[model samples]
Target: MKCLSMLAAALAVAGSVQAAEVQVAVAANFTAPMRKIAPMFEADTGHKAVLSFGSTGKFYTQIVNGAPFGVLLAADDATPARLEREGLGGSRFTYAVGRLVLWSRQAELVDAHGAVLKAGKFERLAVADPKLAPYGAAAYETLTKLGLLDTLRPKLVQGENIGQAYQFAATGNAQLGFVALSQVQADGKLKEGSAWIVPLSMHTPIRQDAILLAKAKDNKAAAAFMQYLRIDKVRAVMRAYGYEH
Candidate 1:
């Protein structure tokens, strides 16, 4: 009888040490990379990552309202900084730096140097909502720097987020769009579209930041996943998705 009792206690302790599942709120631009990384993280640490992808602005509002998120991978550093300032997040760090690109599914529509923007050949151009997405704001900045914002205003079609903006161009709703470099690139090459990699000097850096939410301060799984992101193998996956860590 004592042996059985001891076995029971051991089983309970082992169960208590089992890994946990973490809820991660991710920016849309990082969706692809996170999808690839989540499985690897789980395999390496026995922790499952549950991901939710959307605009950083929207995720901020949700987190402020207690969305039960363990961590946030934001599209911009400012959002994470704001969360830290509000005491909603703890221990923030930069995870990746994003690059913007002007892309089109149609062949020969977008030029290598982005001269196509000056020509104004398209009837409509897609861009994310500048107020809600950092990539959109960067797109605006790029157009303004090129003296094309005013010229292109009439033809602009605003998407709620960069993903939708890319969709607009992909599905033929708009001829071209400003999107994340990862969206159109695979294995260090263009996937199937023409793209003009935007110059870094044209706009401010899109330095993406990650933070552990206050709600997850005591969650071991959350801490493990955050640490996983900093590992060299995980960073390689991020780079494969066109992010600079």
Candidate 2:
């Protein structure tokens, strides 16, 4: 309820901004929410948000290597702060928080509420590279807390980003993977799959941040889009996809 109310207020503010188009480099975990909000953002702002999705580490490398992105919505705060500190970004803001979930494509194979994990039937698990992706870190923390990290370590297959990690599970390349909850959510309900909502006890908070890249600070469209993202409606859309307010 608190999240919803706050989101409403934010969206209201976004609606008041004039429309323009901007280029956004986003983390793969934000795929679902960005898809949900893209049309609305374009319609309301009269600006199109051209997006490039990838791992935060990769994006950071690209930005440093001169990838042309006006704004960056990263999976964690540190990366964006680095951009600001390096003078690559004019301003940085934390727009939302994220949550991680364990998911499998096979619904019968998962018991989100049960100790299905204790059965240990799966041969492989997939996760983004913990050293590179925040979701992967959460997965590692969750397993460690459950006393399963040692047992699961050998079964782990790493992806460069959360999207690829989900692909590993969805394509059955891995029995399951650590993923963003939104991937399994559609229209406010969980999809046909077994999942475990790892307790927040497992990891550090995913404080995702948005930064105004030096290339975009003066771009009215990009700045507008960033402001639009701060609106409650946008945040609400993000929450619906399993992000924190």
Candidate 3:
């Protein structure tokens, strides 16, 4: 029947569409903005995104072990560069740069005018585990550059990743922590907290990059996501969430 033939053709097209989903391993720092951008991507391209968020280091380790991710959004370029060098990723591109902040759950604890370090009022501090999270490396560099590393080191609790570092402060387990700016964006506003945006000059640039994995080299959906990252609307959304293009 003609009607049956038309229905069969429609079903075939649907199957092809379903097969185009891209699985993305995203750094935890980018999770918030990625969430906001993925729907726009889907709307524009008719492809779905499957995302997993964790420390970039951990994600790199997993990818090396065959984690089946089609793309990687890393907090630093080194991971993507490594993937490219290893033939695991076909191409590399800078997506956005991350900004670090000193954040505390308590208003009086962090010092609005940025005198907390000078006052040394807090007995506990938290940072991401430097071995795991890129933000931790930036935090260490910042403190070291300020000549505060030795003094602050004694008061530190290390979280496994930036998310965990934020948790440490949110749960009051640590008085303060270093976190990504994206984590604080809620309802188009920064979260209620006392925060000092760490000067970028204090540390190495957090040059985040995204890559299309080898397994996804031929995947249209995966490539589409990369192009989506460069779109002006997506950049606008990323900027609103404190990402630097």
lDDT of 3 at 117: 73
lDDT of 3 by residue, 1-245 (tens): 45544543443355356547899999988888889888766766677889998999999899899999999999999989998999899678998988998888787667654568757788778899888888999999988888888987889999899988988888989988889988876545667778888888989999999999988988878877777677666777878878887
Query: On a 0 to 100 scale, what is the lDDT of residue 215 in model 3?
Result: 85
Model 1 lDDT tens row, 67-155: 99999999999999999999998788999999999999987889899999999989999999989899999999999999999999999
lDDT value, residue 198 of candidate 2: 74
Two-way lDDT contest, 2 vs 3, winner: 3
- The top-ranked prediction according to lDDT is 1
User: Least accurate stretch of 10 residues (summed lDDT) in model 2?
Assistant: 7-16
Show model 1 residue runs off by greater than 4 Å. 1-17
How close is every model to the real structure, measured as TM-score?
0.92, 0.89, 0.89
Clash count, predicted structure 3 = 0
